[model samples]
Target: MQQTAERPSTAASSSLEIKANPITGQERVLTEGACALLQALCQEFAAEVDTLLARRKQRQQSIDAGALPDFLPDTQSIRDSDWKIRGIPKDLLDRRVEITGPVDRKMIINALNAGVKVFMADFEDSLAPSWEKLIQGQVNLQDAVRGEIEYTAPETGKHYQLCDDPAVLVARVRGLHLPEEHLLFNGKPIPGCLFDFSMYFFHNYRQLLAKGSGPYFYIPKLESHLEARWWAKVFAFVEERLCLQPGTIKCTCLIETLPAVFEMDEILYELRSNIVALNCGRWDYIFSYIKTLKNHADRVLPDRQQVGMDKPFLSAYSRLLIKTCHKRGALAMGGMAAFIPAKDPEVNAKVLERVRADKELEARNGHDGTWIAHPGLAQIALEIFDDYIGKERPNQLHITRDVDAPILAAELLAPCDGSRTEEGMRLNIRIALQYIEAWIGGNGCVPIYGLMEDAATAEISRTSIWQWIRHGKSLSNGKLVTKELFCNMLTEELAAVKKEVGEQRFTHGRFIQAASLLEEITTADELVDFLTLPGYRLLTA
Candidate 1:
């Protein structure tokens, strides 16, 4: 149920009066040796950063003057691109936090009151873009991030006031050429969009930093590792010019693009200096997957409702990410659970249950946190985390050695390829059939090869089936599905999957095998045995 608090108290009112000052040129404090070194560093690498900024500024000036630059560079960098990346080498797996309430006030309250370490003040995807609305949003975000309460919300048809709170509000700006997620200005994908946004953010950052505010940012839709490196370079310039610490600013990247996912490891390495955490970006990533792999026309954006968190690829990705983040000593947070369904209480209840289950699994599996989109959902989400984290953890189960994770990942992801080879198609079928068998039989709670599986884990198995069905539905002529027809289809598809997986010179087969083992297990006891078996990490003591 949605929990609404009583009206704002005097304390809430009192928190709003804090304001930050705008200060300039504090870099003169460096000692002679430090100053000389800093100057030398600037002279050596400043040109690269400066050139990028100058070009960006030039493009912005042209845009304001109603002109387009003669040439626009390709925004995407593929495997073949000769792009050189440089920056702080760090991974932001789960070091930070996310604040995603529907209302700004609610978001601020959750961050300030919940004891969460970081809070991203989202204005791009979360805020609707009406001209007046955007200005009001910008002011609200600026005030929130600045920890100031005196700013007025630009007057809208409805009267809303800004709140004074000492929350760490890291602003999320719109990205360049991102048309689907946000608006596109003029015909050209808003020239200097990122630069201008950064400048505005820097404007507020300088103001707040001078008042002893912390440095924070939530960078979204970062497609390339170069983007991470570029942002680092830009931050370095700002900090250097401001006479701040070398890595004063903190950031979290949203790996929403397929390319971003491919280079996630690299991006994590690049943003090391100030990188904090990462999200399992749901919507944008789904959208990107469809756009990238054009052949599978049938598997177009699945209804978001139909695409549950249990789907194999996403489930594995989520689990893998959590493990990856924790291994690196960073936090691994679960992805966003959208607003509690307003119209259907049943659906809302189910959503809450799934969210709770996911939180339990994440904490059990090793995650620092998760995100929700409403104030009403926040307390429950936190409670769920509390219950599982730092408590009696069940022993972690290990997958059977025979189950090849790389092969499993390949099989789960096979449906997306829609390739010409028979082996690719065969592997996709094998994975889907395995999913249907597990879901229909309630195999989630059963043991498979001595490993325990649960409902949440079961869903991953089911989703793989769904992904495959989506592919077959698209490939075949409106054919009615029968059990035999489905089984035959899978038999053929599994072969293709095997052939393709075999050819992928690079392999992470063990992870795929582990997924296969989880696909079959249904009970916690079984999981204990599975983990205790040779060659696996036991999550539970």
Candidate 2:
């Protein structure tokens, strides 16, 4: 069913070179026209992507050498200037609840039908970037855009189809740092996000326009306003190439990295013409906190669970984000709620209540919208937002949140208060290992221990443990977290995991490889920037 082939020459993409497995059922998505468009995107922007990535390393080296990330002095004028982003599209105004998941067909159908105001078809943290899955995800989104997306239970014969009114569809492309080695132009690898954006926009922009929607995006892991400028340029290039309006491609940037938090105002200024919102990417932000402060022993975090949104640093971050975005006429979106309704009545009630309290805090805090992993929590989020935002107002941009106390670097970087525990350490190892195993095995979003786990959460787990070891943080049980101790715990934890998942599945999955990779990352001389990068290489192995 698979065969190798060379693509036909196109005027625009004659220099494109792609080494990929046959796109079995996805040949139509990668036609000559689409490939040409992708080549153009790579040719115009891929070099800038490399330069930006190198800058990222330079900045990290500064952080590694005792330079705490702070606001850019040269760009202080942008932060202080009076400006507001361009008008938001009508469809994106009331994003009270948004569901995010990998761009698989069944998942896409369900998420779009989920009663949320928006559904983000994720090609980033929630997706395993195998070459086949990448192209197939493009094919799936094309079908969904045309309203021809469907899925049937191969075993039970039940069918699934789209509802007449589906939530607004948006795509979250992979971060700029990720590269698509399978596809290249002029001997340079394509940035993964550009590849995703180009393919989907090329294949479905016209159809989306006819349906009264445009190509919406959620940009992730941005470290500075300059990175945001890069995205703006790419969006502008696309709009010009297609002869569309300037703001046709609307985006929401995630203020996840510590460096990004310092430049919120500057980032919004850069994307003023095309961005509508700023999302608090809570999980990755936690990972970034550990990574950015890896050299500061005084800033080692407590248990991962203990570092909730209520922490002084995080609370300051949220309050600051809300104030900054509101000041610039942009929506301040909240982070994801990881809980799911359990089958047991009492347990599910507690889960719902926890999610409610979380959403209620965000709603009361003036965030215009929040994220949920499952549809079951949509009603809860909707009710909380409705109670706080009311029916007359579409959003809370009117509430500038200026009354809140000023947030400074001291508040944002203050060390959190809590105790580390051996139990939490074991849980982190299990979570990181299993998630990495599933990720490299071609599954990114997975359910482990009854919760939906993605690369973001896994990053938190991985980096937390590494930071713990690097600082020789001691657990509540009086044992110092050292390399030898970590290896011992890893061995025991691997056995416990093997026993939990059973021998059959353990034999078939990549648990051993995952454990090896986890140990390598957590014990390395320097913290691994991202576990997924090494995991991506394992896909070839």
Candidate 3:
């Protein structure tokens, strides 16, 4: 590994101010040097951020006019040409099992020591974007990088620490669409992507390099190759400014949107120098598929439970991801196994069996690794990969199936016969309430009914309700879904939750606020672009 120049100074700058108060002992993480670097990044790239966001809106308008996303004509040459990403870093090569969670202190320690090959410390969907949570998450990352992270719960006296050989750390920053309200430049909030990426890189890039790894990232919700190109520019600028090697910042782009699925080759080509792998963010991809085809009556999705990796559309997407990645010499990572272990012995055994089959399928499909939300499931996923690939970074098999443009588009837009059920509606209402309440309390990932529920799952739940209402979907029992029907169900579920959690905790916490937000978003005349935006406002306000 190459050494970088001397560390930058911690001198405060006049351009930016800290809008949020420092939490106890959090000043050390928000040092003057970190603020200065963030300021520089904001001032230099804020305009470009605006332009890119504007482009997203323009693209959305085109889609609303019944235009389908396809391969960019101008980028056809790059897609057709032969090219491969630069060599993979040693620490990231054999990522057969990766654990993911929010940046909570105990989660960071446990996930790193979870016996997996990689731990993605997420600041995006898995984290509730409270100002204190954001700053403290940076503190936790800094401590983990220095091998000094430890947590002792005040309630249970439980202790946590890192293992002798922890998994490689990869940070998933906020997507391009979010903004960090606490950090402002010239009276405008900084892009959340820039804030999270710059803070982690500015503080710990060299430290990670010293530990034989560099700053690895998982870029989220990218919709086009142009977006990838913009990130490449950001990486180049950050490297030049920090005096680090050009490719020190390795990234894996999450193909989570319908547009991104079509442009995988072009996205990789744009970031070949800094790219390492491409992950099928299956939950969000399904959510995006619903949102993209919102106006097409024929594209209405079935009940969320009916959709899974085995579904024709989802299977096609997964196969396409593996083919595109392997053809370009990059690792193809699989989606999450959100099933957490159940308490009942029989239930837990069944859960593990289901997860085992899922992992085996991924391994058989040539995936380099798969994601597990909880540490207990890691061994199951790891064992399947071990039995299949055995000491190899990834299998040498290639997907020879010829997936054409029409096939890819058709799969995504395919219709389903799964009927809506009253049980499904009730579950969605309960999940939205539960997830939003936990989110308001600063926990982003919550286990509900034997599955890990995050923003993506919540999005799918709420959006499905909205789509069902819009299309006048009927339940399996010959009941029609209407605003009145949903409202009646919401009321019942809310009471159930209150009774379940008890009056004291429910009243003191944000349960009511969570219910109100869920009702507002789900019942609105138009679908909101992101649920977190409104939820975030309640936090900041």
lDDT of each: 0.44, 0.89, 0.86
37-67: candidate 1 lDDT, tens digit per residue: 3333334443444454455445444533544
Candidate No. with top lDDT: 2
Judge candidate 3 against the unseen true structure and give its global Cα lDDT, from 0 to 1: 0.86
- The root-mean-square deviation over C-alpha atoms between each candidate and the true structure, in angstroms, is 19.9, 1.7, 4.5
**Candidate achieving higher TM-score, 1 or 2:** 2
Clashing pairs in 3: none
- Residues 300-331 of candidate 3: C-alpha lDDT, one tens digit per residue: 88789888788887887888888888878788
How do the candidates rank by TM-score, highest first? Answer: 2, 3, 1
Candidate 3, which ten residues in sequence have the lowest lDDT sum? Answer: 1-10
TM-scores of the candidates in the order shown: 0.52, 0.97, 0.95
Among all candidates shown, the one with the greatest TM-score: 2
Cα misplacement distance, residue 334 of candidate 1 (Å):
2.0
Q: Which stretches of candidate 3 lie over 4 Å from their true place?
A: 1-11, 392-407
* Count of clashes, each model: 45, 0, 0
Residue 38 of model 3: what lDDT? Answer: 79
Name the weakest run of 10 consecutive residues (lDDT summed) in model 2.
1-10
